[model samples]
Target: MPKITELRGLFKPFTKPLHRQWKYVWQEKGKFNEPKLTLPKALNGRQLNIIDPLHDPDPNALPDESTPWTSPTRHPMFEYLVPPLPREQHPLFHHDQPVFLFDSKTKLHAGVDQACLLTKAIPFYELPQSIKQNLDKISIPNQDDLIQSYIRQSIAYDATKEHLPRKSTPLKQHRSFRIEYGIPRSRQMSILFENILHLCESLGGRYPDLFKRHLYRNTPFYTTYERYGEPIHLRNKNSYVLTSHTPLSPIVKRLNKLEISSGEKNDEKLSTHDPDGHYLMKGNDYQFLNMYPVYPTIDLQPEELYQDGDELGWRQRKTNEYVHTTFYVSNDELIHESTTDERLARMVMFAFGSALVQARQQYPNGNLIKPVTVQSVFLLDELFHFVVFQLNTLNYNETNDNRYNYVWIDKDNYMYDNRPSMVMHNPVYGTERNLQRYVLEKLKYNPDVFQKFLALYLQGIQGKKE
Candidate 1:
């Protein structure tokens, strides 16, 4: 008993404060649990006022004549000040990164609005009639209007599938990841050339002359050797094996040709994988409509934690919820020396953005809802900045033979140095080095500016930044 008393004495100070806190908590909880009397029923159809209305002067009354159109700035209570903006500076800060603002009164930066306006400069139906007609002729009625339809008809499709639905292109649906040779070796190059010519003629007959001119004249022949810096033999081979030492030009070229062929014909054969050396083997046809495309597997909602005597005091996340779907594309589609993974990632982003726009329009209350744009890029370097650099990097000098040197050249005359030669040769080596350094440095550090540049490119003439 004497030892117990000593221990109690030692704990008295801590116990006193803790007891007080418990009492306070209980008092609050007691009131919460107790029932309050309901207000007396209104008598004689009159509303009851709990407050003295005369003293309050009807608190909801509008401001009097002294108020100004805009509220005057009040002096800060704390001894701190906001930095003033420069006279020439725009209102936005770090415009490229995503930002969240909860204030209802605040508006989106004018530049964002301008960006949206730019997309409208080009209409959905502005494509050439040949490409357009081929789409209608080959693709399902719904997808005929898409850019993918034209690409499919021009590049991937064959003559047989005229009325088929877009049951997933080989680009998206090939189950086994194996490389397959298309057409016999004797007529491989010949077939590609003929296909290109045929597509051009078909496009020319159905589309406007302006479009035909671009398609036939500007578009390169459907040879893998002419696109990526790989040999013609590398086409339809597993990229991992070939790209280990070979440049990507040939593989990229071949896949591009295949894509165009499929697009033009809308044939199911375009999506087939090689089975027993038969590249065009008929495979299990899985319908996109039948497939239940699932959203990303993530629990977007935050877990709730309950305290002893309180409702949630705060939420951890404002909007972490998102939906994502995975679609496959042929690694073959993205072959070639010029085909950086970064560029491919950018392509994926663009496709998703376009799809998001369509989805927003289709959903209920979409106009009023501002959805967050979230995407994962497939290629490592194909961020917005990398995409811009690539677009600007295209050689505009069509007359220069070496300009297309980045493409794969024929190996038939390997002894003759038949490979593509460097276009930027210099009599003085120092000048060439300096120029390369300047361009390389610019791309490395200041890529955000280039991203802005490409964003502007996506805009039409009416889309010039104000």
Candidate 2:
């Protein structure tokens, strides 16, 4: 006969917990804090079996004796709060165009404009002579000439590496382009709502009726789901189905309606994840409007060359590179700030560049059904500079371009001290019309570049209507 210890070893596998049961216990108590309860022992030197009463076969019992354990169905307590009808179909609900809002709180630290005129400037030529020379050397296809011309005009590289002395070696070139720019990850939506409120108020003062009809304070949520072909038993083993939410825009609804009306096959089913969109703008404080869009760019580190064996000269080696895509506007007023005409020019260029890229993405394959408009607001401490650009054409074939028009409103001097001016006003319940008239008069009397821009903007608006 086998010893008692050997018999216990023979039945050890049956007495031990199954992998699934062990996992459940571990999940409940955590790996480090497992329970100290004694495990089941073998029965009579054989595998022990404890039949559950619910699953046991009883001849006299009903057919429901083998019912598995299941969690009780739960109903949300707030189910009564959900409205019977959809909010969008409600008579009181308002739906309007979505507005993109950007805010920056960077303070003008050092007056670089007063110190050195050339230090902070980014020089560019409309038709740079270097572009012609570059074109002469490189046989660029006719299709690519326009883009090459734009690049030549926009970028200038230092040739110090090419003319280095014999003893001094140059670093390897590692240029990178940023996919997206502005607003750091940590502070992306930090002041978004605050800035939206200010923008609404400012525009509302000048165009009350337009604001009421066109501006939307909220957007609906959109959700998408994906499913995998798996058996029902293995559905929970891995995530067989996944669900996610996407940002909703008013344009999406308009597109969907157009698709349905045109009898086009729509692949996407549009529905809101939330009953109502998030409230973006609230409160009366308008100080957050004085924010700027930080340009996205990559920083290149100095390249290091290694001399592998004396036979070969110094060769460039690959190195790890760090890239930053998100940069948020800061509200710290004590930071030193510098500004120059060149810096401002570069900022404008980047603003237009990014806007153009976004426009191209939206209206891909040369689709010009609707014009693209980008509004950029630059906040320099207390100063505010608003720029509006309307892209009428997006053909890259034309080397010399005249398809876009822009208006820049620089309210630096008048609104510098934060006084009650034409642009800056106290919030009044019923005095919007009076404020509009006051702003229009101020625009007429102002002997600045903004006055001419405003006139042009009004002309464009009127022309569009006609």
Candidate 3:
């Protein structure tokens, strides 16, 4: 590994220009208008198994004669919760509750203006197998230009790798997949309800409606499930079909009537997925406004809206203030010790003010909107969350006085700290980071991946940094 000083020196010069270039290129090409080049689906073409439960023995269930063993347990009520109840709960409800607390949905109401957290896995699975197989061979507009441009970048990075000690490699930064769904127009609003009806028809009962009603009733609320797959299973599983006599909401019932043709029990054309097995068919439906895929591109710094005096330090202050407000500071003692509603009021003001300053510094002639400028403020929360994770991973929880264990003082009187442990410890986090790193290493050595790291870090900061 390179020395910290040497790495810093090597990285410092490239930060500003690279930041400008990344912002420009990413913002320009990240929009829906940017034609997504198609690639062949990988898993879509497989001979997916959709076994009938009646035809085969229960795969998910444990054999009745199986012995049960106990393991060490943890949790507040573990001592009282009794041991080794049964072997039936094989698929244990071991959910990451902490992960759900900082879910993407929470950020929607926060100041994260127009963000997209498109899971590559979901899109990759949704495409047809035939289409995915031919992805590499597909000829799409602007695709070649982008690839060529990246290739040239890679060649340059390869030539200079030794001096720079490149931390990231070049890889295809942009990917797109195609989706095709032919849902009838009338049934568009009630897709969930209609899907339940199909389940009932297939299984010869009115059962699918229970899950639909449950989900519908809990819409726009914080809900939890043992598994994300449970919803899919409830909709697709053939055996042990769930039934409910629950009546649908007026809107759903009307929409269902409109969608079904006279005496037509099924709308086969619009549906996609294995009839014999359960696997989610993922894609954006262009035909439906609510369900359409939002291929979004966000402008981090709108050049048209810029103001002066915005520097790195100012940006930090602005970001801090935004985080303080967005997170409910319910602790009365913390607020009472301070003389001013100053802390709360200062939060939004400083964030917006600094954002304006930062934007103006980048675009001297641009017009800055105070509200939109606060978008950068959203990034600060994610940053703080990372800091907490770093501290926690280092066994330095802030709730205790040992927080100092995670901090180090630099010669410049600056505090140098470890990148948060949050990204390192979580399996999902590790997976994403590893995939990104893999892609980076594959690409020609460049700062683009680091920039992506920073962006995602900012995103995490906004949602979870608090």
Candidate 4:
């Protein structure tokens, strides 16, 4: 070799070291030795007793000579409370079956009964034959045209100086005409319009004139432009657009807030790199800015309402001021195992939990003046579970207090077990009929609740005018 250093330099330029590719390989095949864990049984085999002895009397506990009495000062709505179904009457109660009540057939019927009663005011009937014959002629675009014509009437009225104007053309001829109309640009509005069109089609199949009348008189549409504001596109940042067709004031107000934020924030960049982007500062950064004065407001914390214990398995913040509903759907295992009660309880938690979150969003200021109603529905394949809860107090912060009450009707097993193919053809009209019957039954037992719901339902359907 010329020199060791020279040889090394030559080898470094041409030679490559052989390296082995390594991968994680078990010396012995891995085994999943850990046992699969089963879900813990609800209440650890303890009996579930939801009855309040102080409020609800036990017929069995009465002495032989004791006479039954009713409260004179009982609230008007107290009569509407559904009495607990007997164990013998419960569908899931069998000597061999697990003692659970929630997802049982009885509970499902109770939920459905309550839901049906809650919105009993909504009309659901088969359309007349004359409308059905001409259904093929109706189209979404045509409906849009009709709605546009109705909107033009408002525009035309606004343009006139009143005294010299001729009688406005009758907008009722248009099948899509509504007392209140809004621009249909958003995905939600589009979906709503689609559903309206479907409803029109369904009703048109039977009574075209009635369908037209309902669309024009009963349904309300929110537009991007109205007499109260400019076209949504040209409106300034502070302008609020009415987006919902529902008459529920609270829901409408919430929708307005959404529209305002959407309009103002649409063009604003969210990234810190943008010149006009806003950032949340903390500690010293926030202190240095010395922002606008903050006012004191009630902070409604929904999370504080939840309690977990062995007694009832789970508890949630409930207010007697609002109606609360629970729904449950059992899985195959639960259904096979006859664990309806546990299923029902789980469903109630889910349904109520979701409603609670929505309520917080809808009433962010925490000044809900009207009673809040909660309807919970649980579906297990073909089985339907429903419950209605009324919250009498908004003070959900008091976790220890039993401030809410509920009614359930789960004895009847209303099945919507139509196959997907059959649904496309027939579309399960049985549920509507069943709901109607439930409403009729409630009307007989408690017409006041039905009337109260009707007023609220009508108010929601006929949304407030500007």
Over 320-425, each residue of candidate 4 has an lDDT whose tens digit, in order, gives 1222222232323223344455444333433333333334444767554443434444444334444333223334334453223222323223332221211111
Residue pairs with colliding backbones in model 2 are: 104-291, 104-292, 109-337, 110-337, 183-327, 184-327, 184-328
Name the 10 consecutive residues with the lowest summed lDDT in model 1. Answer: 238-247
For model 4, the stretches where C-alpha displacement exceeds 4 angstroms are 1-334, 397-412, 416-460, 463-466
CA-lDDT, candidates in order:
0.24, 0.27, 0.25, 0.29
Model 1 has an lDDT value of 0.24
What does each candidate score in C-alpha RMSD? 28.6, 29.0, 37.5, 32.5
**lDDT value, residue 343 of candidate 1:** 32
Per-candidate TM equals 0.18, 0.26, 0.14, 0.24
**Mind giving the per-residue lDDT tens digits that candidate 1 earns over 1-466?**
4677444433345446877766755655445454554555654366544444334455445456675443245356522444444533534333333222111112222221111121111111122221223332322223212322322322233233232111222345453322322222113222333332343334323333212121111111111111112111110111110000111111111211222232335445444532111111111111111112421111112112211111111222333212121111222222333333223322322323322332343353533122222111122112121111000012222334211101100111111111121122223422323433433333223222222222221211111122
Highest lDDT model number: 4
Candidate 3 lDDT, tens digit per residue, 294-313?
A: 32211111111111222222
Model 1, runs deviating above 4 Å? 1-89, 94-339, 362-418, 421-466
